[model samples]
Target: MSKSDFGLFGLGVMGKSLSRNLAQKGFKISLFNRHVDEVEVDVAKNFKAEYQELKNALAFDNVEEFVASLASPRKIMLMVNAGKTIDIVIDNLLPYLSENDIIIDGGNSNYKKTKERFDYLQTKGIQFIGTGVSGGEEGALKGPSIMPSGTKEAYNNVSQFLETIAARDKNNLPCCTYIGPEGSGQFIKMVHNGIEYVEMQLLAEVATILKHKGKNPNEIAETLDSFKDDANSYLLEITADIFRKKEGDSWLVNLILDKAGNKGTGNWATITSAELGVPNTLIASALFSRYISFYKEHRVQFHKEYIKKSVSRLNLADDDLLKAYQFVRIINHYQGFKLIQEASEKFNWNLNLSEIARIWTNGCIIRSSLMEELVSIFKETNTILIHSKISKMIIDCKPSIKRVVSDCVLSDVTTPALSEALQFFNGITTQHSSANIIQAQRDYFGAHKYQRIDDASGKFYHTNWV
Candidate 1:
C-alpha cells in the first residue's frame, strides 16, 4: 500500500482519537508511542489491534518505522505532555526526519517554549508548528477547534488537514485557523483556558447563591436551563447536567469534593497576566479561589469558630441574578480579549481578534452565544469597553450586578468572581478615584512626584513636609 499521509506520535487518548478522526476523514495515519514501560507498550499494542481493521490506519512499535512510513516531506503531530516530553520526541524523531519535514506540538505548551523549539528545529531544516487542539476527548474523536502557528510555509502543509478535522459553527465554518508565527496558537489557547476558569467560577458562585436560598439541585438546574435560550453556552449547559446527575441517593455534585483541581494552565494565565502588566483581576481571583478551597481543614475550623445563629437569607430576584451573570460574563470575556490584544502587540503576533472570536464560537469549552456578538463587535470596534453599545450595556447592568453582589455579601456568601468583576468595572468607569490621595501620600513620604490636574498631564510636582 501507499505510505500513510501523516503520522501521530504518543498513542494516548488524544493521539489515538485524532488518528481515528483523521483516518475517518480519508487521510491515512501512522501511529506510534514511546516505549516508556510495559503500560505504554500495551497501550500501543491495543491501539494497533483496534485500528488495524481499518485499511487506512497503520501502527508501529518502532519510532523509526513510524516516521519512515509517512509520505515524503513527512508531517507528524505530537500529542505528548508539554515541556520536556516535546523536546525528547523531537530529539528522537530528528534522525528519521529530512529537510522540510514537519512536527506539530498539539499540547498545552508554553508559547515561549514553543518559540524556542521552533527556532531550534529550524537549524536542522525541520519545520516546527506549535498548534493547540481544544475540545476534550469526545471532540478529538469527532472534531475540535484547531489553532496552528508557525512559519507560513509550514502552515500550508498542515492547514488543509487541520481545517478538515476541526469542528464547525452554525454557518459551517471550521473552528480552525492559522494564528500567526512563533507560538501564537499556544498564546491564544492560554487565553482561552484563562477565560474558561473565570466562567466556571462564575457559574459555581451562581449555583452556590441559589443553594443558599433553599433551591435544591433540581431547582437550580431548572433555573440554569432557563438561560439556555439567551445566554446559551457549553459550560452553562454542562453545569445544568451536573446539578441533575445523581450518585447513589445523593446529588453527584454534592458528593464530589469541594476542593478544585487544576493542571497548571490557569496558573499560567495568572503568571502571564502579571508578566504582561495586564490587570486580569477576575481571572486572578478565580485562581486564588481554587487555592483557598484547598485549605478545607482550616476553613472548617474557621467556620466552627465564627458560627452565628439565625442568619437570614437575602432576598434576590432571578432577573437581577441573570443580569449580573451576563454582566460578569462580558467582563471576563473583555479581560481575556484585552490580554490577547496586549500580548499580540508585545509579541508582534499581528493577531486578528475578530477571527479569534469567530473560531471560538464552537468546540471549545468557552464556546457561547456571547462569542457571536463579540465577533461582530470586534470587527467594528478596537476597544470593546469604549464602544457606545457595550458601554451602555455595562452602565445599564451595573445596578443589577451591584444588587447581586450586595445580597451575596449580606448573606455571608463569597462571590469573588462577581465582586472582582464589579471592581474592575468600577475601576475603569471611574473618572476621578481615591488615587489622588494615594499620589499625595506617596509624594509626602518617599518624595515620589505627583501629577497635577491643573498642570500638563505628564508634569509632576513634589512637595516636602517637615
Candidate 2:
C-alpha cells in the first residue's frame, strides 16, 4: 500500500468531519483513536467503514502502525480534548516522530499552553503548530477557517493541505493563513470566540425585544432575513434558521432552556483581554450574561420580590434596530481586534491584521460584510475606530443605538452587551473623560498621584484635600 500523506488522532465530531474533508481533498491519511474497552472500540475502523471518501484511508488501533503508515516528515493533526490530554498525545507521538515531523494541535487550546508545547517540541527536534479551526461540523466537512502558527518553514510544509480544505471567500480565496509564531493562532481563535459571545447576546437581545413587540418566531426570522445584505453572517443565518425550526405544534427555540452553555474560550478571551489591558467590555458583559443565566432560581425569586415594571412593545423601526445591531457589532469587533493588537505588540508577534481579517471573511462564525470591508481597512489603520469608512458608519449608526438603548430601558428589557458597547465607545471617544475625577478620588483615598491638563511636563502630583 502507498504511504499516507497525513495522519489524524481523535475521532470526535470535529475530528471526524476534518478527516472526511481531508479525504475528500484526495489526501491519503492514517486515522487513529484510542480503544476504550467497550466504550470506543475501533473508532478509526468504524469511521472508515461509514464514509466512502475514507475508503482508501488507513485505520489503525495501534500507535506504531499509525505512525508507520505516514510518509517521512509526517504531518499529524490532533483533534482531541484540549489541555493535559494534548500533552499526553504529544508524549505518545514523540517516541514515533522523527526530526522535522510536524504536529498540529487543532483543538481550542490556551495560547500559553500552545507556546510551551511549541518550545518543548523544538527541544525534541520536532515541529509544532497551534492551529485554530472554526466553522463547526458542517464547515469542517466542507471548509473552515484555518489559522496556523509555528515556524514559517513548518507552516509552509502543511499549507497546501490546510488551504485545500479551508472555506473560500467570494473571490474564491481560501480562508486560511500562516499566522505569527508561537500560539498566535490560538490567541486569535480565542478572541474570535469572545466576539462570537457578544454577537450571540446581541441577537438574543434583539429577539427578546421583538418578542415583546408581539412578533412570533417566524416573523422574527423574516425580520432577521431582511437584514441579510450588509449584515449577512453565518451566525445570523443560523439564528434565523433556528427561529424557523418548530417542534410539532410549537417553536422549538421557545421550548428550549434559556440558559446558554460555553466551552471556556469566551472566559479565556475575556481574562486575556484584562491581562493585556484592552477594554473588551462587550465581551465581558456577554460572559457575565451567561453566568447570570445559570441562576434560574435566584432570578425567579428576584423577579417575585422586585417591583414589577410593565414591559411594552419596543417603539423602534426595523431599520433603526438594524442600525443598532450593526453599531454594536462593529464595537464588538473593535474590542476583539484591539485585544489581539495589544497582545501582538506585547508578544512581538508581528501579526498581519489584514491577513487575519481576510482569512475570517469566510468559514468563520464572525464572517460578514463588515469583516470583508475590514480587510482593506486594516491595511491603512490598525484600529477600525479610526478608519474613515468605519468612522462614518459608526457616526451614522450612533443615533440608532442611543435610541435603542433608551427604548430597551423604557420597555424594561435587559441589554447588558448592547449598553456596554455604546458606553465603551462613548468612553473611548471622549476627549476629556470622568477618569480625572477617578484619579482625584484615588489620590484622596490612597495617595495616588494625578496629572493636570496643563502639565505639559508629564509629571504626576499629589493634592491635599479637606
Candidate 3:
C-alpha cells in the first residue's frame, strides 16, 4: 500500500468525520482505533468499508501498522477524549514514532496539559500540535474552523491539509490559522466555548422574556428571524429554527426539560477567568444559570410555597427586545475577547485578536456578522474600549438594554446573562465607582491600606478611626 499522508486515531464521531473529510480532500489517511475488543475492531472495519470509495483512505487494526502506513515525519491526529486518554494514545504511539514526527491533539484538552505534553514530546524529539477543531459533527465531516498552535515547522508541515479541510470565509479564505505556540489554540477554543455558553444563555433569556409577553413559539421565531440578518449568527439561526420546531401538537422546545447540561468547558472558562482575575462576569453568570436550572425540583417546590400573586406583564416593543438582545450579544463578544486579551498577555502568547475574529467568522457556533466588524476593529486598534464606533454603539444601545432588563425584573423573569452584561458595561464604563469604600473597609479591618484621590501613584495609606 502507498504511504498515508496522515494518521487519525480514535474512530469516534469526530475522528471518523475528520478522517472522511481529509480523505475527501484527496489526502491518503490511515485510520486506527484502540482495538481492546472485537467490537472495537469491527467498528474500525465498518468505518473503512463505509468510506471505501475514497481511494486514499485506509484502516489498520494495529497501532504499529497504522503508524507504519504514514509517510516520513509522520503526522498523527488524536481525536479521543481529553486528559489521560490523550496521554495514553501518545504513549502508545511513541514507540513507533521517530524523531521530528508530529502528534496533533484535536481534542478539547486543557491548555496547561497541552503545554505539558508539548514539553514532554520535545524531550523525545517529536513535535506536538494542540489544535482546536470546531463546528461539531457536521462541521467535522464537511469543514471546521481549525486553530493550530505548535512549532512553526510543525504548523508548516500540516498547514496544507488543515487549510484544505477548514471552512472558507466570504472571500474564499480558509478558516484555519496558526494561533500561537504552546496550547494557545486550545486556550482560544476554551474561550470560544465560554462565549458560546453566554450567548446561548442570553438567547434563552430573550426567549423567556418573549414567552412572558404572550408571544407563542411561532411568533417568537418570526420575531427572532428579523434579527438574523443583523446578528447573522449560526446560533441565532438555529435558535429561530428551534422555536419553530414542533413535536406532535406542541412546540418541541417547550416540551423539553428545563435542566441544562454542561460538558465542563464552561466551567473551565469560569475557572480560568477567576484564576486570571479577568472579571468574566457574563460567562460566569451564564455558568451559574445552568447550575440554578439544575435545581428544578427545589425551584418548583419553592414557587408553589411562596408565589401566590402573579406580576403584571409589561408590554415591550419588539424593537426594544431586539436592541437589548443585540447589546447583550455585543457584550458577550466583548467579554470573550477581553478574556482572550488577558490570557494572551499573561501567557505571552502574542495572539492576533483580529485573526481570531476572522477564523470565527464562519463554521463555529459563535460565527456572526458582528465578527466582520470586530475583525476590522481589532485590526485597526486592539484597544476595544477606545474604538470610537464600538463605543458609540454601546452608548446608543445602553438605554434599550436597561429598559429591557428592568422590565424583565418587573415581570419576575430571570435574565442573569443580560443583567450581568449590563453590570459589566457599567463596571467598565464607570469612572467613579464604590470600590473606594471597599478599600476603606478593608483598611479599617485588616490595614490593607487605600490610595487617596490626591495621592501619588502607587502610594498606599492607612488611617485609624475609632
lDDT of each: 0.89, 0.92, 0.89
Ranking by lDDT: 2, 3, 1
User: What RMSD does each model have against the real structure?
Assistant: 1.6, 1.1, 1.3
Among these predictions, the greatest lDDT belongs to 2
Tell me how far the alpha carbon of residue 311 in candidate 3 is from the true structure, in angstroms, after superposition.
4.7
Tell me the tens digit of each residue's lDDT in model 3 across 40-148: 6556667888765455577777989889999998999999999899998899899999999999999998999999999999999999999998999999988899999
Model 3: ten consecutive residues of lowest lDDT:
36-45
The residue-level lDDT of candidate 2 at 34 comes to 95
Q: In model 2, which runs have C-alpha deviations exceeding 4 angstroms?
A: 307-309
lDDT of 3 at 254: 87
| Model 1: per-residue Cα lDDT over 1-466, one tens digit each | 6798888998778988888889889888888877757455655566767764445577787988888899989999999999898898899999999999999999999999999999999999999999888888888888898889999999999888899989998789999988999999999999899999999999999998888777999999999999878688999999999999998889999988799988778899899999999998888899999999999999989988896654467578877888899999989989999999999999999999999998899888889998888988999875888877778878888899999999888878899999999999889878999999999889888999888878876888988767
What TM-score quantifies how close candidate 3 is to the native fold? 0.97
Where does candidate 3 stray beyond 4 Å? none
Q: Worst lDDT window (10 residues) for model 2?
A: 307-316
What value does the lDDT take at residue 281 in candidate 2? 94
